[model samples]
Target: MKKITNAFRLTLSLILIAVVFSGCLIREVEQPATVKTGGEFQVKLTITDKTADANAHYGAVCVLAPDDWEFVSGSYDSQVGTGIFLFDSSAKPVYGNIDSVLAPPAGMKWIKLLSDAAFTNPADVIHEATINLKVGQKTGDYNIGYFTTKNSADLLGSLNMSDEDNDNAWSDTSMNHKVTVELAVGVEDEKVVPTKFSLDQNYPNPFNPETTIRYSLPVSGYTTLKVYDILGKEIAVLVNGSKQAGQHSVQFSANNLQLTSGIYFYELRVGDSSASDKSEFSEFKETKKMILTK
Candidate 1:
């Protein structure tokens, strides 16, 4: 009976080995552990395995973003996949069989999300989205996750039940497919600010190829900083966007515009963005003179 016992022990060991090897096929999404709200930040979506694996092809990916955050823009370096994003107030929370045809049905607001195009190498796919805190957004922790629609075997049409060949690697298929991130909102309130809007004179006035212009805003608003020649003709737009209430600076490069040595004026215009005091700062504009030698 000793020979029989040895054979049984060997068989049991082989079964345990097969079970352990078959458990690590799927992968989870990784991202930063924390992000600051109010300020713009990037949400990166990447797989654990960094190597460009040959079998990592995915047909579709769906990402569910936090409801309170505002969608800014997608990362400029999105890999070979087209994306569709939505942010509708009338949208409702929709979660279910992500692979189902009706998962992301029409009109789902409050959820800023992205649906990716098919035919992508999972390992090579690195996605990023820029987001910021919605006006008056509360600070807290949030989770962001994605679900893949098609696995490697499902893409290549080699679906099988058992891992006899161990060819599949779609390991992470949990329901809560997300990573947690802490968001600290309203942190800007404690920061200092100027009492009023002001624009300072550019340094190195007679600059060779570049000069710097400094300006400050007392409150959050849309700002426009433009460079104009002595004749009031616009030379270049240095800054044109919404900015927080703080001191800001931008550089002027005369090398690209082929601007000759001459006197130029820079102007700063501020427009109210808050609905409560929309007309309070309608007439905020400042101008400063600068000279460029070469």
Candidate 2:
């Protein structure tokens, strides 16, 4: 009887140890290796489990930009309150039970995450979030915060962790994983704005008889610009030839053709370089709407 009782006690102890070890084996979350100002960066939160029994509920993650940065757009999973945004497996933004924007920036960008779903199994679940931030040209130091809930009731606390340390605890009472990012010289300052090409809007938007269109080029190349109706049907060819870049204009007179009073679109295409010695020509195209009030 004593031997049987000892065996039972040992089995119970081993089972408890295994359960604790399994819980701590959740997948590690990681931030992007590189990101650019005014560009999109992917942030992933991965939860790995093999038993399908290890689940997380009311999970959330947020990226806090530096004081000089600003938030442009984001892909969130679920929204609990004001400053929070939510996203799903398909990466679509969805507003949750919360309505008011929780944390409005006094002068900078801030993002938050909130959810209430209960996890039932141990499976690797990945939550991908995209955020566009505008950073200054100067190099500096920045910090990012990651938070999540172990259970549903603590969702709000998980959304508020931002400080350096709370015994490694976040605002959501979850494990806090704070990361520091460094900005290098000449890394974030370079800007790329389209140059050497300009497409202008048509004059007299709502015209009774005619209107004019204009475009400019910086170098010589084969260029083509054509106009199309709302149905994408070709209507007029404005310019089609190899011409030197600098400045050029085209006038589309509506009197000659059978016309309708509606919207129109246009596009321009530049061909590739034929030889390695020559630089490839850049292409620029834009569309403008015209109205025939007649």
Name the top lDDT candidate. 1
Query: lDDT of each prediction vs. the true structure?
Result: 0.43, 0.40
| Model 2 C-alpha lDDT per residue in residues 16-130, reported as the tens digit of each score | 0000011212233334444443332333333222223433444443444445544333332312211113323223123221113233234323344333233444343334333
- What is residue 65's positional error in candidate 2, in angstroms? 39
lDDT tens digits by residue: candidate 1, 116-223: 223334343444322222312334444333332242333212222231212243332212322233344355543558777867556554468887777778888977
Off by over 4 Å in 1: 1-191, 275-283
Which runs in model 2 stand beyond 4 Å of their true positions? 1-195, 272-282
In model 1, residue pairs whose N, Cα or C atoms come closer than 3 Å (at least 3 residues apart or on different chains), thus clashing, are 25-169, 25-171, 26-170, 26-171, 26-172, 27-172, 56-122, 91-108, 91-109
